[model samples]
Target: MIGEREVLTRAQLMAGGLSRRGLVRALNEGVIVRARRDQYVSAAAPSAVVQAVRIGGRVTCLSLLQLLGVFVFANDVVHVHIPRGASRLRSPESVAKPLGARGRRRARLHWWPLSATPPAHSACTGIVDALAHAVRCQPPRQAIATLDSALNKGLIGFADVEDLFALLPRKYRVLRSLIDGRAQAGTETLMRLMVRGLGHEAVPQVHFARFGFVDLVVDGWLVVECDSRAFHSDWAQQVKDRARDLELAKLGYVTLRFTAAQILHQPDDVLAALRGMLGAGRRKPPPRN
Candidate 1:
C-alpha cells in the first residue's frame, strides 16, 4: 500500500512488502514515481501532494483541507508545510533546482513547526495541524465557517476542536463559541454569523413538523436559506424551494433566501437587507388548526 494519499518513502514501501527488487520493478513499470531521492509516490497520487513533496514539504493548510473534501474558502495555490528553520527548498518542477529558480513561486509555504509528527508516509500534514494553520490563514468569520464545515462533515469531532484551538494563539480562542456543527454549508455559517453580528439569535437547521429542516431561523420566525448553486441550480429544486417558502408563509414565517455569491461576496448588501427585514417586526406563527 502506498498510503492513503498514495505517497510513501522507499523505506515505507519496502516495509509494506515491496522488496528492493519489487520497488525497482514498480518504478520501472511506472507503478510508482520517485518524487525525491527516497520519496516515492504512486502514479495515481494527487498532483498537489506530489507537487508538495517535490517542493520539499507536505501539503497543508487550505490546500490540504481542500484535498480532504473539507470546505475551504479558496485554494488558488498549493500550501506547503515546511519545517521551521528548513532551508534549501527545491522547485516543484525539478527538485535539483532551488525554489523560485524556475519562475513564479507555485506554492505558499508555512514554516511553522508542526505540533506533532505526521505519519511516516503522509504526503500531507495531520488534519489538526492543517486546521490550526487554516484558521490563521483565513479571516475570522471564514475561519469559523471552516471549523463549522469540518465538524459538520464529521472530519473532526468536538474533542478535536479543543486540540485545534490549543495550536492557535490565545486571541483565536474567542472563536470557539461561534462554531456550530449544525451548519451544513459554508454559506449557512456565514449567514448565521451575519445575523448574530446584528444582535439577532440565529438557530441553524431547525426542523418543523410539516416541513424538513431549514438552514437557519432568526428571532424564531425569519427563515434564512443559503442556496448554493450545487444544490439549487436545477428548476426542480427551485420549484421545491418555492413551495417550501409558500408553505412557510402560510405558517406566518418570512423566508429570505440568499445565494452563495451574495452571502460570500456581497455580505454588506446581504446584511443590509437582513437588517431592514429584521427591523420591520417579527411575524408570529399562527396556532395549530
Candidate 2:
C-alpha cells in the first residue's frame, strides 16, 4: 500500500484530533515514523527514504539507484536531495553528520537541488539518480555503459536523458557527450571503449556492404568486432561473422574479433593487438586525400 503524502502543518495538527504533544507521543509509541517536525509516516510503511520523499525532500542519486535495484557496489548511506531554498532536511543530528568508523568524512550528503525531476517508475528513481552521479565519477566510458544498461533494463528512458541534457548547465558539455556516446551496451560500447583505450582513432558501428555492421574500423584497413555470448551465441551468427571477415579481407580490410570477456578481463592484450594493427598500417604511406 502507498503511504500518505499529507504533511501536517503545526496549525493543522492543533486543529486535528492530535495536539503537538500528542503527535510526539504517537511517534514515541511506534505509531508513526517522524521524518521531520511536520512530516510523519505510518509505522507499517516500507522505507524511511520513501517517507522522506512523501514528506517533501526529493530522493536522488545512489539512494534512488538502491531503491530501484541497480546493484550499487558501494555507498550504503541513504542520500536525500532537497529542493534549493527548502528548509534543511530534518534528519536526526547523527544522520546529518558524516558516518565513519569514528565519525570522520565517510557518508555522503546529496543536498543539491535538481531544477526538475522526471516521473518515477515503480521506485526506479535510482536510474536518474545514478546517471547524475555517474557524470561525475568515471572512466567516462564505464559510466556510459552503465547508463546504457539502465536504459536497456527499463530503469530510465530516452526522454529522461533528453530532459536531463537540456537541464544541465552549459559547463557540463562533456557529460552530455558521454551520455550520448553509447546508445547500446552489451558489446557495441564495450568495443568502442577498448579501441579508444588502445589509442586507435576507430569509428564505431561502421556499416559495410559485405560485413553488415563492424564494431570499430580504423582507417578502412582494420575491422574489429566485439562478440558477446548474449548476441553472438548462435552458430549461424558465428558463421556469418566468419564469412563477412573473409569478404572484408578480400576487400582489403584486416578483421580482428574480440570477445566481451577478453576486452573486459584482459584489456592490455586487446590494446596491444589494436596498437600493432595501427603501427603496421602507419608503416605504409598514407593515401592521397
Candidate 3:
C-alpha cells in the first residue's frame, strides 16, 4: 500500500521494483514528477498536494495554510515556490497528477529566489517563504489568519510585519493593517475581523467561568463559536459544544454558532445576523445570571 506521503526517490522507486523506464513513463503520464535529480513525488498522493513540495518547491498560500493546520477557506489551487529565474512549475500534465477543480489549472507556481538554496532533494519551503506567500497571495481575511497564527506561535511580531510588507509589492502592503495576533483559530481571525468591522469590539479566546474558553466575545457578552469540521465533527465534540452552550446561557451570554461553511460561503448572512443581534443587545444589557 502507498504510504501517507508520496514523496519518493528514484532509488526508492527502483527498490520497489520499478524499472527506470517505468519511472520515466510515470513521469510522462503525469503520475509523478522529478522533484530534483533523484527525488520523485506522486501527484495523487493524498488530500494535500505533495507533488510541489516533493519536487523541490515550497508550498505557499492556501496550500501552506492547509499544511500548517490552519483554517483554510478556499484552496483549489496547489501553491508552490519555484526558483525565480531557473525553476518551473512541475505539477503540469506531464509531471504530476492534476490538482485543480474540473477544467481548472492544478496549481499556482510562485517564482521567488529563496534566501538559502534548498538541497538537491528538498521536501518543503522555508517558514518565512511560506508565511510571506500566504500574506501576498491570499486575500485580506485569509491572510490575517496566517499572520495571526504566526503571531500566536510567537514566530512573528508587529514590527516584523512592516518589514515583510516592504518586501512585497505595494498592492499587498495593505495586509499589514489587518493583523491581530491574539486570534486563536483561522475562523476566529475571520470572525473577529468581521465583528470589529461593524463597530463592535470583538475579543478572541475570552474566558467565562461556566463556559471555560469561548472563541470570541463581542461587546462583552455575545459569544461567537466557530465550528470547524475537523475539530468538532465527532459525537463527543458535539456534546461538549452543547454543554458549553447550556452553561453560557446561564451566565447571560448569548452564543451564536457558525460553521466554517457558513462563515466562508454565506458571510453576508452571518454578518447580517450579527448586526441585528448586536443592534438589539446594545439597546439594553442583559442582567448578570
Candidate 4:
C-alpha cells in the first residue's frame, strides 16, 4: 500500500492485495509512477517528495517542514536526507543521470544516518529525525524558530524536542531554553529573539480585553505584530489591524508592525530599529490593578 507520502515499493503493492496484472493495470492507468528501479510513487505525491526519493534520499529538514505547514525561514531548495554511505545517487530531475556537483547545489543534502526507521513506504523521514537535521541545517535563532514552529503546531511534543536536542551536538543543547511553543509564527519567534537579545523580556501572545492576542509585548508596553500576507494582506484586514493598534494605543501600548519580509530578510535593520525604539525614553504606563 502507498505510505503517508504516497511512496511504495513494488513488493509492497504486491503484498497489499494487488495482483501482478492489477499492478500493471494501475501503472497503465497512471495510478502510480515508477520512481526508480524498485520504488514507485503515487500520482498524488508532492513533486518535491517524489523528487527527493528520485534523488536517492528521503525528504527532510526544511523541505518536509514546509510541506507539513511548519514555518521555515528562507527555504529555497529541497532538503534531502541521504544515508551516510549512499552512492550512485541520481539527480532529482532524472533517474539515470548521476547527482553530480552541479546537481548538489539544486538540493540541500544531509548525509547522515536516520535517528530511527521511517515508515516502510514513506518518502519522508520521521519528524524527530527531520527536526534534528533541521536544527543542524539552520542558524541558531532560526533553528529555535523552526523547533518552535514544530512545537506550536503540535507536530512534536516537548519530550520529542528534548530527544531532538540529544541527537544534536553538545553546543546546541543550550538552545533548548529558548524554545517557546506559544509562538504563532516564525516571524514572532525571530522578533522575540531579537528583543531578548536586547535583554528585554519578550512576552508572546499577550491578550488585552477587547483586543485579541497580540503577537508580542516587550517590557509590558510595546506591542510587536508580525504581519504576513496570509492574514494581513487585504484592505479589510489592514483596517482591522489599524483599529486594534488604535484601541491598544488608548490603553498606553505602542505597537510596532513588521512584515514577514522585513523580519526574515532585513533582520539586522529590524534589530536596529527595535533597539532605537526601546531606547528612546518612552515611559511605561501604570500597571492595571
Candidate 5:
C-alpha cells in the first residue's frame, strides 16, 4: 500500500485529489512526516548509511575501508571522490565538485571531483578511493596502509599500483615509495622505521622456529616484535607469545619488543637501544638442527 502510494507534488496537492489541506492534515495527524521535498523516508525506517554510499549511490572510499575492516581513525565528514563529468550538482547540498577543473567553487563537506571514472569492482574501488583520500587528507602512512590492505587481499592488482602512484602529488614521494614497497601494514612500516632509526637493517618478515612468523628481523639475528595492544592484550595470545619468546631465546635469537606508542612517540629511545644491541655484536645465529 505504501509502495503504491504516489508521491504528491506541490502542484498536485494544490490541484485537489491529494489536496494541500489534506497533506497538511496528514502531517498534523502523524500519518506522514516530511523528510525532504520529493524524498520521504518512512518514520519507522532504519537510518540510511549515507556516508557509506557516495553521491549517486556510488560506494565511498573510506566506507570500503570500513567494509574491509581496515583501521581508520577519521570520524569527520566522510570522503567521497566524484568522477569528472559526473552531474556536478546531483544534489543541491551534495559535497561534490570537479577536482582539477579550473575556476570551480570548492566547498567543505563536498570534495572536488577527480578526472577519472571510479571503478565499480570492489578492489579497484578501494585502491582508487584510498589514493584519492590520501591526496586530499595528507596522511601518507594511513593512506599507504589502506592501499596495502587492498593489495594484500588481492582487491587491487599490482599493475594498478603505479597508475595510482602517478596520480599523487610530488610532495608525497617518499610515502608513495613506501606504499609501492609493500609496507602496507602500519605495524610493519612503523617497526621498519624504528629499526632503521636504530641503525639496524630491517629483515623481511620471516618464519621463526618458535615464534612462528615474526614482524621484522634485524641484522638477521635480532627479532623485533611490534605489538599492537589489541593482539597482545588477549590473555591466551600473550601466553603463547611468551612461550614463543622463550623458545626463540633458547634457539639464540635475541628479542626486542616495542608497543605501538613506543614506535610512534618515543622512537628515538627504540633507536638508541637498537644501536647498542647492534654495537654489541648481536648477530649470534640460532642453534642448528
Candidate 6:
C-alpha cells in the first residue's frame, strides 16, 4: 500500500508489524523519514510536503499547481490551507511574508476551509478546493493556464469547472470564459488573452488540412506559434516546426512564430506584429458584445 499517500504515523508502523528495532534501523539507514511530531513518511517524499499536512494544513494554490505539474511561476512559498482559526503551521523559513492574510507572497496560507479533509487526503487540498484557491487568488492569465492544463490532463472536467467558479468569490467568476483546455501552455493562454483583449479572436491548438494542431490561429488565417525554449531547443524540433509551417502555408495560412520569452516578456512587439498582420489582411476584428 505504498500508493496511498505513502505516509505513516508511529502507531501505524507499530500496527503494521514494524518492530522498534526495525524502525530504528530504517531511520538509521535513511529509508524512513520523520515528518515531525510522531509522524513518519517515506524518505523519498519531501519533508515539507508531509509536514504541511502533518501540521494540520492542506497544500493549495501555487504549491499544489507545482505538485500537479501545472503551469505556476514559482513555489517560494509552501501554500497550505488551514481551517479558519487554526494556527498549526510552523515553517518560518519559507513562509516569508508576515502572517495574517491568505494571499501573502511567499508560503501562502489560505484560511478558508469548506469540508472535512478526509484523513486519506489530508496532506493536500482536495482538487476542487485547491482549484478554487488558485482561481480566487491568481491573476486571470495564471488561473486560466492552470485550469487549461488540468482540463487537458483530465484531472478536472466541465462540471468540475462550473463547480469551481460557483465556489470562487464573485470577482473571479468572470474568468470562467477564459478557461480553455485547448491551451497547451501558460504562454499560449497569455498570448490568446493578449490578442482577444485587443478585440481579436484567437483560437488555440487549431488543426488545419490534417496537419496536426498548431499553437494558435488568429482571425481564421494567421498562425501564431510560441516555442518554449524548454521544449524546442534542438535542430530536429526546429526542422519539424518549419516543415509544419510550410505545409500550412500551402493551405493559405500565414505562420508567425515567437519564442516563449517574446510571448511573455515582449508583449508590445507581439501585439505590434499581430496588429500589422491584421491590418495587412484588411480584416476587421469582430465586435465584442
In terms of TM-score, the best-performing candidate is: 4
lDDT of 3 at 104: 26
* Candidate 4 global TM-score: 0.94
Model 2 vs. true fold: TM: 0.55
For model 3, what is the error of residue 186's alpha carbon versus the real structure, in angstroms, after optimal superposition? 1.4
lDDT tens string, model 2, 1-289? 1233233444655676777788778779887665555455456644535434443454555556555554333455545555557653343233343233442232334555454454431222345554675545445556566565566667678887776556545655564554433334445566666666656556766676543667777665677788878778999988988898878766767789888788777778877887777777453322311
TM-scores vs. true structure, each candidate: 0.92, 0.55, 0.73, 0.94, 0.62, 0.86
> Which is superior by TM-score, 2 or 4?
4
Stretches > 4 Å off in candidate 1: 4-6, 19-25, 101-104, 285-289
Residue-wise lDDT of candidate 6 within 1-289, one digit each (tens)?
Answer: 1222455677888888999999988899978766555666677765446546554566677777777788764457777777778764554333332344442344566787654464652467678778888877777787887888888878889999988888877888788878889888888988898889878888998765456778988887788998998879999998999898778766667889999889877889988988887768644333211
Candidate-wise lDDT, in order: 0.86, 0.57, 0.70, 0.88, 0.54, 0.73
Candidate 6 residue runs with Cα over 4 Å from true position: 1-6, 54-56, 92-106, 283-289
> Least accurate stretch of 10 residues (summed lDDT) in model 2?
98-107
Global CA lDDT computed for model 1: 0.86
lDDT of 4 by residue, 1-52 (tens): 4644867777788888999999898889988878777889887788778889
- After TM-score superposition, the amount by which residue 112's alpha carbon in candidate 3 deviates from its true location, in angstroms, is 3.4
Cα displacement (angstroms), candidate 6, residue 111, comes to: 1.3
1-289: candidate 1 lDDT, tens digit per residue: 5754756777777778889999888889988888876888878888788788888789999998898788877777788899877777778777677788341367888888888888766788998899999999999999999999999999999999999899889999999999999999989999999999999999999987876899999988899999999999999999999999999888888899999999888999999999999999866645422
